[model samples]
Target chain A: MHIDAIQTPAVLIDMDRAEANLAMAQDLANDLGLGLRPHVKTHKLPGLARRQVALGAVGVTCQKLGEAEAMADGGLADIFLPYNILGAAKLDRLAALHGRVRLSVTADSAETVAGYAARFGPEAPLTVLVECDTGMGRCGVQSPEAALSLARQIDAAEGLHFGGLMTYPPLGHGPETNDWLTRAKALLEDAGLASEVISTGGTPDLLRAGQIPVATEYRPGTYVYSDRMQVAWGHGTLQDCAMTVLATVVSRPTPDRAVLDAGSKALAADTCGAPGFGHLPAYPDAVVTGLSEEHGVVDLSACTRKPEIGERLRIVPNHACVVSNLFDRVHLMRGDEVEEIAQVTSRGALT
Target chain B: MHIDAIQTPAVLIDMDRAEANLAMAQDLANDLGLGLRPHVKTHKLPGLARRQVALGAVGVTCQKLGEAEAMADGGLADIFLPYNILGAAKLDRLAALHGRVRLSVTADSAETVAGYAARFGPEAPLTVLVECDTGMGRCGVQSPEAALSLARQIDAAEGLHFGGLMTYPPLGHGPETNDWLTRAKALLEDAGLASEVISTGGTPDLLRAGQIPVATEYRPGTYVYSDRMQVAWGHGTLQDCAMTVLATVVSRPTPDRAVLDAGSKALAADTCGAPGFGHLPAYPDAVVTGLSEEHGVVDLSACTRKPEIGERLRIVPNHACVVSNLFDRVHLMRGDEVEEIAQVTSRGALT
Candidate 1:
């Protein structure tokens, strides 16, 4: 099917642009002599993950076990889940996934490590990365000492391999992040632990991955499909964005206001300091003033040529990762024609 | 399955609370001698829509043809789609639906009316409501005169039936809205056109619906599952909220910070003048400070009690309608027991 033949409020991925993005990220990682591990959360399609692997990425990073299971089912060998896993239901699934592939997970607390130790044995070990809070304050232990304490617990556990350390760096602060990681690695080495890998992730600071003193690998998710937030952070221009929501102007209620079929449902509501929900590439000055459930109210007052009713527009969402989770399937577009329709297999896999 | 057995980041509906909320709205409409048309966009489940019909709803209001089709498939006869129907693809589906159900749609302009007229014939006419801008500036004709002009166009059209006027009124403006509708109905009567159903909708103003002198019917969507937005609007207290997002505490990165498994993907990013994304009943003073794709960072600084890892918490989302569209299925809970797991059958059916 052609791109226009598809329905409105649909997810359209420019395959060529996506492939170019993949090549660029891999090239940067190669130039830095660091292993590239792209996060599958950005584009949860296994086809894309396989392409990333085929294009020299060592493995993939997943935030949830359901995502890891989906990728493993698609024959992905190495997978890293960088979130604290708790509860018997999740540990059971994690153990099953661990048996299928070379699995690694992150932990910042002793409780999470103990849960993993109870699930797996020494013969069949799971790599555990001590997640550190360099600066981003969302997850991970507070300091290098806290990270070493978690690493010690993982090393002392029965069925866990103390892999290394990982941190999701704050944007535009590569040097300070590197110093933190280096200090943590030095502490781990002094404690007679081998820091096999040091994983750092931030798409905005991806190109500066080489500068991180002891980092052996980098994981970038939004680098696969740069969005409005990424562009706002100066990661790349709008030209680097691969994913765009194909929406049609459904209601022209007034001369300055046009409503598109795509709203919070299609484009998602993750506004990373962007003025509106998404950026309309066709109308650069038109602001997505408001969003209801299925109506994107666009202010066309700034546009010299406003879009008419039924006219299609491509919208770059505020955050690409959240947008991917909104749709069940996405149209892989090769120019104006659709190459394939891939199901977002890991969508809503927040278990 | 029990309520605790369901996975994290799941949508849970208190069946008793839901039934009570439904009865309250139905009783209000009955006392006012107004036909109640509950908008199915909130629940999107046929079972719930059936319950609404069983209680007192004259029909169900839908925002899209796809939703109306889903309701029609579930044995719902009267389905009002208050959206501008355009394009041959949608009109074809609309024509088929018009034959199967007692279909009515809204028109804000001649273009939308022409599309409906071109699809249907006089033998099987489609009801077209002149959507008037009674001040909610989303999708409606600017004034009552424009509404009257569109009504004349619908009356002249061969395949259309001028049903009446409809307005999604701005909150707390019942008096002004009634005056606008009264004048529009008076002008229609002066022009010798029958205004059959003067429909108005707004959950915040649903209780004041009877005060709208010319309104014969009322449509209320979010009242079935009152959300944080409704509570903020002073429509009802938090106790009246039926739907809540059941999420698990995943991580405690700091003394004042905890993360839940639900984020934008689960709880949604729609902030209806609320400071946070959703309201936590357990931690009323706590704020959902930030949200990533799969993690909601809760600031527990103001709380005396903080949620522990693996502990489940119920969250009242900002907008119930948008939250309903985020999940594939919702858990219907009767106290602590899971009565049913109903599929959101009309989910992502956006054409």
Candidate 2:
């Protein structure tokens, strides 16, 4: 597509690359006997989620109820909201989704489960998976006893159904992970209750998927849009990444530094440990030194070649998931041509 | 409006507070005898820009052609883009805008000015201002000689008019600001030219604005939407700040921290050296320790109160300008009541 025809600071998706990445994950899941639940939160594009289902994903996973509702609206029959639902507002929305689609949600505390129960009503029991703090200390119960306590509360409650256990484990490799999962499973098994499903995964930990043998399902989001952080962290190559931010050089006021029109506004600033604003595939060495509201400063002094002002450049954002959440829609491109403008159905589904 | 009706991650602008802030800034500018050309890059809200104009602004300052178009659509008559315009496409867009409004743009290099000349034609000469680097090393020419050289290029060009001196003088309050503007004016006046319009201002340096005698205009974006940084850096108080992100606690897996539904998507990750994803109005001491794509972790272990799940909170974004540029529309409200959903008229005017 001619850069001038498209608006500046837009998200661009390569259909071929996206499809290939989707297929790769499906084949791996099928071969490994793992249920593929593609996290729709990464793309927030219903079309991408539909493609994942078509490629053999068991269900779509979302981080918020609003996102799950959007996916359901997009015709996904099965969805899992892997986020804690707290208020009556979201619980009401979740109840509505549960009635429409085959829905399951997560909860870490008794208060949250009780709150959901209060909203879902006594007769219409809502499915809930107890969350366990595997290695990520951000959320979930620390011990299996704590998990069972919440699970048992749900099991006894009138308006709640125990669906199993879930955890967003730390992205790592080797016996440390193997040991942790094994112990977690042992603890659950000793509780005299078999977990119908144990959900575990993230794009960063895809390499170590083999270690989590007890996990029946994997929820990987960034695999579909592998980015600078993924490539730098040794997760995926640049070509394997499907999504990119198409930006133009708005100002190069000096010889050493140039600024792009896409700043954190387009990028969303979830660096995820990457070194720059976004990667310039054509010029890999350039460093995005600073970002103002509408301006991104790229220090190209280190590069062998100079990039001119008004030049269109593809930036693989530091965090692909956050980048996907930035735009309302992204152009689905096939090579150098525009194919479609797929609405990001879950763009602002933060609730 | 019921907090539930106000969408999660939606920006709520307090009209009364916003009007007061606008009045204060315009009053400050009037008292100082400086032309108040309020920066449109901050609000990107036409209504706010009009209110500034009504408060006695010389003209509105736009950062992009699309922004200028939006302002013109809002019935604004004049705009100033204080940055280099590159490429035939962008220059053409600017030329088109000149028909609807009086447009004045900035250029730092000779090549960019030449492109402007090529695009605007003879009868539609583009109004030009040379952007200079005083202390903020982000953009503009380095020395007074360099500014003079670029100014001469604009003067020599067929479709370009030299429009005096401009500099986004470094962010802090100091004597260097006056020193640089004075020296730059001397250099221009020595070359048989007078610096008629001197434009220089940033929110941090607003208190010291009177120091620069040559500066005839002041452009400050963040004064309208003061944020956490502004409050921390002594720019404004929380009460004086007019905009905030209203989010819900979506996750409270641990007693120490809880994650909110509004992550980088709502906050825009514009952390300007302040702590936390956002500050809870009721709990300012809380720290936002970490943020995922859809989850913001608020640490309240040390604070006197813990944010329960489903609790609604207001966040003063790390940086306000970037947050303003994220959405298609911003909901204007007055004390828990949403009034209108105003389109960001210039949401993605990157080029």
Q: What is the DockQ of each candidate?
A: 0.67, 0.52
lDDT for each residue of candidate 1 in B279-337, tens digit (9 for 90 to 100): 99999999998777788889999999988877899999998887788788899999999
Judging by DockQ against the true structure, name the best candidate: 1
Q: Where's the lowest-lDDT run of ten residues in candidate 2 chain A? A: A173-182
Error of 1 at B237 (Å): 0.8
Clashes in each model (backbone N, CA, C under 3 Å)?
Answer: 0, 2
Which candidate comes out best when scored by TM-score? 1
Candidate 1: how large is its RMSD?
A: 1.3
TM (B chain), model 2: 0.95
lDDT per residue (tens digit) for residues B231-342 in model 2: 7777877787788888777667767777787777677665655676666777878888777766777888878778777778888787777777766678787767777888
Docking class of 2: medium
Off by over 4 Å in 1: none
Q: Which lDDT tens digits does candidate 2 get at residues A1-351? A: 644577677888887998888888888888779899999878888888988998899998988777888888899999998878766666778888889998888888878888877777567678889888877767788787788788877777788878888888876743464565566667667876567788887887776677788788999888987887877777878888888888878667777888887877677666656677888888888988777766788998889897887788888888887776666678888887788887776554465
Candidate 1 residue lDDT tens string, A62-116: 9888889999998899999998888888999999998899889998888788889
- Report every candidate's CA lDDT: 0.88, 0.79
- Flag regions of model 2 displaced more than 4 Å: A2-7, A121-125, A173-194, B2-7, B192-194
DockQ of 1: 0.67
